[model samples]
Target: MKIFPIPCLEDNYAYLIIDESSGEAAVVDPVEPEKVLKVANDNGVSTVKLVLTTHHHWDHARGNEKMKELVPGVRVLGGSFDNVHGCTDRLEHGDKISLGRDVNILALHTPCHTKGHICYFVTGKEEEDPAVFTGDTLFVAGCGKFFEGTAEQMYQSLCMILRPLPKQTRVYCDHEYTEKNLRFALFVEPENEHIKRKLLWAKHQREANQPTVPSSIEEELYINPFMRVDMPEVQKRVGRSSAVEALMELRRMKDNWTR
Candidate 1:
């Protein structure tokens, strides 16, 4: 299983998951159809299937109708059918979708970034680690903003839904925010060596114009300020004695951040 990270529309990402053996492919989060179609066509893979949406946000699902039109008879799978454009399949928790030989995706409903956000877990065929498509829910160094849910919901989604995944799980988020997020982490935890090291590494990756995604969940636990809200140090820094308050503070800080 080969996952291609195609960056789209002003930091947004739409992925192309290819099955080498069968030469079949699935597009995850098609923010733009032309780029996705061109990539798939150039790679000689069929772009007749898609994992429709992470949420109803335009930046995430804006290409749904165009993509369906570009590839007639395409199967558009999403979390909800009501608001989703051209949704042919509505998926929920514990649903498994097959791409090709040795490629199976398990959808986990992680609703914090949005009320209907879902993450896709895909295992690689060879020695490669498993990959997760965490659309707006979990990023490399930061989680998505709470647009439709609360901090408590985000806590559960992180601590429960995403934490249990294997430590080596590669997180493919929907944006290239690792560098910025690491900067925010530095502001939050000036004494954290883990964050400092990650920030340096992320800077190098960005300098080389490479994708800074597929960050391990273990790394996120150590460097991401949002995931560290449960830590006593983070609670103290946020001027809060409770984990919930810490999370709220972190969220508020990120919301007001300019740089």
Candidate 2:
């Protein structure tokens, strides 16, 4: 499986997952149909079999109808929620959707950013390592704001669902918020040299007009503050007893933090 991160409106990202042997592809959270089509054409993939939406946010699911129009018979799959427009197939937790003969996308219902948000875990024949399309639920060094759920929900979503993925599983989140998130991570753990180094690397990547996404779960475990709410240092800094409480405090701080 080949993954292409297509940069869309400002910092948002939409991914294109291609099955190399069959040349069939699936697009995740397409904000713009033309951009996705162009990328598919450039990669010599003419058949787009599926359109997977992570959430109903405009920046993520706006191009669903247009994409369907562009590519006839493309199955639009998303969470089993009312707000997801153009969703022909409603997916739930643990549901596996097959792409071509080898690629399988497992839907994980991680609802914190939205009540019905879901992340796609991709594993297949040609992939060297599995990958997860986290949408806005999980970022490189941060997680999304709890727009529809509480801290407990977010904590469960991050720790129980996402954190347990294989160490090498690549996280393909839907934004370029790494540098800013690392700044917050540094504030949460001032002595963490790993966070400092990652911030510097993200700065250089941005300076070179490159993307700092597709971070591994292993890297996130070391540098992402959201993933460290259960750690002693993080809990102490947040002055919280439980993981959920620490996550709440950290989220509040992040919401009010200035770069």
What tens-digit string does per-residue lDDT give for candidate 1 at 31-117?
888998898989889555655477778888888888888888778777752266667888888888888787888888888777878
Q: TM-scores across all candidates? A: 0.94, 0.98
Please, what are the lDDT tens digits per residue for candidate 2 over residues 99-178? Answer: 98778999999988999999999997754799999999999999999999999889888999999999999999999999
Off by over 4 Å in 1: none
Cα RMSD (Å) per model? 1.6, 1.0
**Candidate-wise lDDT, in order:** 0.84, 0.93
Model 1 TM-score (2 dp): 0.94
> What shift in Å separates residue 154 of candidate 1 from its native position after superposition?
0.6
